[model samples]
Target chain A: MSSTEAQVKEKKRGRAFSHFKSLVMMQLKDKLDLSFLTSTKQLIAKVVFFVLRIAAIIVAAYYIFYYSAFFSIFAIIAWVPPIVMALAFSIIFILSVLSCMVGLMKTLFFADDNRVLVTMPVTGNMVFFSKLVVYYLFELMRSYTFTFPLFIAYGMVSHLSVGMYFWMAFVLIFVSALPVAIGALLAIPAMFVYQFLKKYEPVKVTLFVLVVGAVIALIVELIMLIPENINFINDWPLKYRPSVISFIESAKTYILPLYAITEMLIGTYENLTFTLKPSNALVFLYVLVTIAVVLGIVYLIAKPLFLKMTAQPFEFEKKEFIKAKENRKRRKYKSILRKEFLLNLRSSISYSFLAVYIAVPILILLLNKIYAAMSTNILGNYMIYAFNLLIILLILLSSNGIVSTMYSMEGRAGYMKKTKPLDMTFPLLCKIFYNSLFSLISIIVSIGIFGAFNSSSIGVGGLIMLALTVLFFHIGHMVWSAERDIMNPQNEQYATTGGEINNPNSNFMTVMAFLVSFAVAFFSFILFNESGVNPITACLKLMIIAMAFAAMRIYLFIIKVRLYYREKM
Target chain B: MRKSVVLTICVIYILSIVLVGYLGIKLAIFDPILYVQSIELIDDPYSDSYKISHPPRYPDQDFVVKEYSKGLKFRLYCKVMPENATNKEVEFIVNMPDNAVGKLQITSDGEVSVLSDDFDILYAKVYILSKDGQKARSRDFTVQINNFKNPT
Candidate 1:
């Protein structure tokens, strides 16, 4: 009733709106920064990249929609078209939630900018609200980046009505919100869990292993869904087909969100005419209602939590102060190696990448089992063996890429290496040894698993020969990789920015990972199949070459790298 | 031009194009896809919808043991829509069970061969593809194993 009270309220609203606009613009500047696109060549490159990406999306969508491959594959699983739509939507929803959770947590609480933004002359709620809007805009943009091209491509491939395009846009906008809301609700808990993990190292490692294991289990389950008997193809288990179809059909009507969207978009338009079904209106209403309720809940719980977290994120972090160990007499190199390991352990990037590396053996084993289960007509025994080695070597080599950035990651601390009267070779060995040791573990585990279960033909003696060959070759590769880093170190970029800015080392390593994996496979295929040599004999020959290569690389690396080390110092 | 120093590539043609002044590149964007106006996989090509054989034994359930000798072969046929769609080619392959000692062969052109007399009924699938050359097409089909001499 009071005009002055109302004016104050209006002023606050105006200020909040201004802050929201500025915050969103700030994020857009961060993400879609085009300052790098200064060149005519760069413009051409961007245009070409855009064109190619569009072409890829069109090609993929066309294949999945207009082409028979998509249909027949679905038929193989006894799934109809509607079910495919349902599954696709569900997968997108899940991914959106996951990304939203991670992004929200990082931006809201963990980001360095959180301190600056929260301290600004605005309500914490205003800051939180703007972040969510910008986040939602980004999430929507991301969804469209993945999907909108396909929409256009599908329409171009097939004549879709303007109504259909409009309907898709409508559904995409609302459906996207549901996931963001879900992600926000999950974010605080996830951050708490993250803090818990940061406090406990073993727990973090174990959780990551468990996550990878869960992925393996899911893959196994999906693979197993392919029935063993061809007779079971039509009515798998012969009896359940009707009941399964009926259940899906019924679920399409009643299943809350997935079915509502599915029924509205896919199954409704039989004649390809976008006639507004009464049910479509109802589904639209349901979608709006669902988003409203979920977002309302997110506001109720997450908003307060965000404000609290903005004020004091430390509340969640249960810091365990480990007592410093008494300085004991240890070898200098040992201390160097231990320090290197500890540095990598603390880094979130290094920690996660290491976790992936650790799980490589299981992934290789499980993947190889899938390959084994397939009864290919043309591929022979040697092809399988070669592929198995390729997987092992490929993963090890790619992960070992971090070794190239090892010295560069030292940043300002690297100055100590230059100044201290220490043997440069000692530090170089420290960097090379730890990751090589990691690769060695992964390689042996993979080979051991392969030797144990993959094939009986490769006896223990044969396996030892193969293992020795790979081990020697890997040592050569790691040293060569380290030498490459010393030759072109980006010490300042990494030290100052602390981000994974593009580097030649990673780019070259990725190319080599594929190249080396394939070359070894190609050569083995030739040696074993073309020459008609037994697998054991092939291993023996490879071992000798690998040993020789390792010798030359190590000898050359030691002599050459010391000079570069001195120059840098 | 302030940032011209940052551009690594100093190509004459590109620079000339930039001078010729910001004319939009006219690409067809036919970038129109590989799409069909309407594509539906007719699972059972014959009879209104899918119907099992008389007495209705599913491969997952019971099988009708219509006796037939080894080396029996039959051609499985299925049609895709437009009735005149050019590349309606499909591949039929039988999935072998874990305990399957007997093997069946299905050809690229949808010919099913019963190689062993050890097994009863085998389930098969068809992969229909577009070998339109520019792009490829395929249709996959699983069929009822019809033996030439099976006495019903």
Candidate 2:
């Protein structure tokens, strides 16, 4: 080619690279920056949350090492390292897919900056490519956290060489690329499905519930299929134990990328030499080729669809209906609650979250089936020990998040709550009541299912006590979040600026929920096992503790509501 | 400044509550009484088999049985946590065939003397009771003694 032509081509390439870099940096800044804080409270909240997140990571790493030690003993006996790696790879794959699916949806359709970006001079492919890069990095972080500790444990136990460590690190850097690419392939279709469901109100919840239930069940099955648990299948009455052997075989046959990754890791680590085994080299080639092809395909397919889907606003069409005379006489609180209910139902995102909320029971039922299949009477009791906490975490996520966002979702319309003659707490209470009702019913159903199908020794009294405990905690969580929202209405303040949905306090709620659930479950299980107390008596004591906590939270909620009225808007 | 004071107080209160709850959990779950730390079979000189401290409440795996010549004595050596060793009560329960293959005796310590040379093989359980009585004879460990004329 001519020199001028080559120069021009290089210039074009440079320009494109700069565009992509700028876009990615902007997206990352928008998502990661905590500089919007003006108050001491917000800054402190940010610092506290950061510390908590780091603490969670450390705890997770510690457990990974601890568990890996036990598994490594099996490895020494039966060459279990490869099998463990395979299972870990599968988990990482699923986690990457789920997280990337959610993250892509937020970045593509739900992000506030998308409208302005689409109208810019840059091509749609460039924007999509840059966003994909950000998502790839995020998935890489997740994958590293999961795989690194296990890798270290395996290395320590197996006496792996320095060469193996360097090779493993090299492989780890590129491992997440394939899963992120696979996730991108699913993101567009998922968006279409959700959009279609958004149009159909009546069937949406049912379909969404089935989808979430299936996803959760699949994850649970994957977890159980690990090689360490494969022995349980030996005594299983069923012909198939859903063995890890079969899972690995299927992964090699179907999900070739995961198989390739696992093969490479095992092959490279099994020897002290720097040289890769022939099998590892072949699979490594497969990994590289598959990632390239998948990325190419995803980029081509998503390029046009990304712009079209993102440019079109996510609209949940408001239905206008004449008010019926018969419904006009409903009590004010009931009317307000009914209105809040319909409002949430009208938002597709909100409704989708509701489906996940409802799916908690279905997941519990699935877990119960698995537990019943594999567990002895003793292990069955252990499942019951953590059962109440699992339900409460589900409630916290499903109910509290939606309830807390009730007022903030009003946007410019929040002035009505301030201006309306109705008692401020009246609307807040209605929302909380509506949220608590949904969760309370869910808790009751879950308790019944656990008692009947789980083969748990928690008994009827334990079940009732659990139900009451979870119900009170759910109410407390909802009230606490509602009071926070009323005191600090956020989304409406930033409505004109067109940023993302601003629910800063929700993260705190989630962190609190996790801590509380972990503490409750861990301690109660230990107490029931170690202390000579009867299981029912122990459960009752735990219930009383939970009730006291809820009572304290409610007192604060009432005080906050009273104070909210005293202050002027 | 007033708002910051209230916020700080709230943060402190929440932290204190969490700390107290953690301690309460520790109090309830913490095991006061010490238990068996390890067990081994000393019958076979060629092979050494040992199981490190079984779970406090659950004995999931069968104890490894070591076989020896018919004339050899079957001995089990168990090590318990040395804490409060004086007050601890250890019991040894043996179940043999109706033909009564072996004579068994357990010392105040956790050592088991099985005279399996009288007949064939034998099985026994080691139960340890805590001094506090908070822990009863909950988890009983198992042992099997096999009399093989040939040790491979």
The residue ranges of model 1 lying beyond 4 angstroms of the native Cα positions read A1-16, A36-48, A66-71, A75-80, A149-162, A195-255, A267-275, A313-322, A352-359, A370-379, A419-422, A452-456, A566-569, B1-152
> What DockQ does each prediction reach against the true complex?
0.02, 0.02
Please give, for residues A246-308, the per-residue lDDT of candidate 2 as tens digits. 555455556555655766874543211223688887787777787899888877777677777
Candidate 1, residue A204: lDDT: 82
- In terms of docking quality, how is candidate 2 classified? incorrect
Tens-digit per-residue lDDT, A452-547, candidate 1: 654567678878877877787778777777777777888898898987767787667656756766687678666666545457788877778779
Interface RMSD of each: 23.1, 16.9
If scored against the real structure, what TM-score would every candidate get? Answer: 0.70, 0.56
How well does each candidate reproduce the native contacts, as fnat? 0.00, 0.00
